[model samples]
Target chain A: MPRASLSPGAVVGLALRIVDEEGPDALTLSAVAGRAGVATPSLYKHVRGLAELRGLVSGRVLAELTEIAAEAVLGRSGDDALRALMDGWRSYAARHPHRYSVLVQAPLPETAEAGDRLVGVMLAALRAYGLEGSAAIHAVRCLRAVTHGFAVLEAEGAFRLAEDLDESYALLAHMVVSGLRTAREMSAADSTPGR
Target chain B: MPRASLSPGAVVGLALRIVDEEGPDALTLSAVAGRAGVATPSLYKHVRGLAELRGLVSGRVLAELTEIAAEAVLGRSGDDALRALMDGWRSYAARHPHRYSVLVQAPLPETAEAGDRLVGVMLAALRAYGLEGSAAIHAVRCLRAVTHGFAVLEAEGAFRLAEDLDESYALLAHMVVSGLRTAREMSAADSTPGR
Candidate 1:
């Protein structure tokens, strides 16, 4: 693991590993360098500092999440797509709780391109329900709020009940799908002629 | 401000103020003591240390949130109670973003009476929908996830679009109410004799 052998992507990959294994609090330049078998200074050659390293990690994770979500919803739409997307998100968070925590805590990249791409996938899924612009954004935010919130709470072991989480999650997904449909119907009713 | 005069409640209150003003990261025991005009070591008489102080703060805040939510839904039922409870939660989070952050980050106390009370308030509100048992827990979890997630994301400036957030929130509330009704209807249908 010579400095010449270490690329920016390699450094970030190691940093992601650190976060995944030891939690976000353990992700420091020294820790990453130690794990990667490179000098701390050599790590700086790839990332300016911890802030930039965190940004890179966040961006990378967001992109990966976007890809997973996109693949889940491929050739699917409406409730099917929503369920697939949400289940994918929950699975990703469960598998990499620390990395997911980083995504929630770290600010999106300055350009926000990665975030936008993630949102784009969501908007595309919402298209099945004929929502766009602000309506779709509202629905997307609602969906994100519930799924992200549930995943974070679950990671924190906040749900103390004895019931199976998978069953609980299914029920949550049902509510979201039902809720989106209801919102669409309301919007349609508001646009129609008076009775 | 003297150690002899400082009560545990007073120390916890001052700690809350520190969290509210400067974010949870700044909530050191020394910071709380300095703000209260007491010596750091003397503050320990009131709180064991940072961990206990955080637990006390979390328990206190959760109790406060439960009170606010309970009051909001008093004499209300169904959609009215749901709307009031969610709005109350949103407002509390908005007014004290850092404190809300601590609520999310800090682990609930071992006794968890405060946390259970909060859930009790949620269940009472859902009673209007004729939901009980696991269904009610699932619904309560759904409500918590969406409202908590929305508040956290909003505090992080994740909602960057120009749309009126109040309007979006209103739409979300509408969706949740409608969804709950729909779920109720579906549950009733499944239990009926007809196909």
Candidate 2:
């Protein structure tokens, strides 16, 4: 077989395709090269090794997710922004289950800039609730927990009841917004004079 | 070499050890047999095959988790029960990371009695908040999402900030309780007559 022309971007794309179709466990250098119609030795010219290839794919996926999330909450705030962000997360996971799994487990960049950017957008949205610093961080973590956990279970078909998922997801979003508001209220009460 | 005296229980014990020490990927019949001082063929006398072994391990892990969670919520209700349940989940995951992962991904029993038993305990806890039917199910999913997501991320060192985890967990517990209260209030409002 002729060695196909492959760039680093093309290599990452092929790797992503492989992971999406066959799951992360099925990803290997030889398999990727085979799928790309390139020799195993020639593939190394694009990506340093399997680890680098995975990292590139992870970075790309995170970048894309962050972009989508940013756009979702662009003109929204408070509960509306929260709903948009949550919807964005669930939709991304639903549309790309394997890639989402990879994103969760993949070795993100050492700087984690892409992740931080996504979190920054979340913080901006939560600002409408008067959260900042540690409070904001905690709320962000809670939001992430709800979104990631629900998405994983949903993808795995763990919610086996006949209930509509949209209703369930909406309830979850409402719960998070309510939680954030309560956190803000409690924080306010703590700083107030006298009971 | 004489074949070791290996019962099914002992085989499962050894498999659990392997998974705890080297992760699930390292778990195999040959590896378990080697560790158990039995030939690979002799291992079949105890477990039918790899699939059965994994199933046994998964069953055992789920059973242990369910028991732990049940005990934690016993003699508790409302926010207290919720806090205990969340702590129970986080503690179990911390104490046995590998087992927790298996529980999440394992092909749980089709009947899922053990899982149902665990959910039953969660439902009992949620009942204190006047939740039932789909409401209870949604609340339970929310609880599971927070606990599972936090535990998974914590185990992976995903939260790199310097903040104390105990504080963060407390905040999360407060958030969940608040969310439940708000959800209950919303449901109540929806049922009430003219504003």
Query: Alpha-carbon error at B70 in model 2, in Å?
Result: 0.2
Name model 1 segments beyond 4 Å from true. Answer: A1-4, A38-42, A108-111, A184-195, B1-4, B108-111, B184-195
Each prediction's Cα lDDT score? 0.82, 0.79
lDDT tens digits by residue: candidate 2, B1-195: 544768999999999999899877689999998898767989888888998898888888877877888898899998888889889889988888877776656654532666777778888878789876788887888887778788877765667778777767877787788878778666676569995
For model 1, report DockQ: 0.52
Of the true interface contacts, each candidate retains a share of 0.43, 0.42
Give lDDT tens digits, candidate 2, residues A1-195. 334767999988999999899977678999998998767988878889988888888888888888888999999888888889989989998888878777656664532776788778878878888866787788787777788788777766667778778767866777787776677566576579995
Candidate with the greatest TM-score versus the true structure: 1
In model 1, what lDDT does residue A186 have?
68
- Give the TM-score of each candidate: 0.88, 0.88
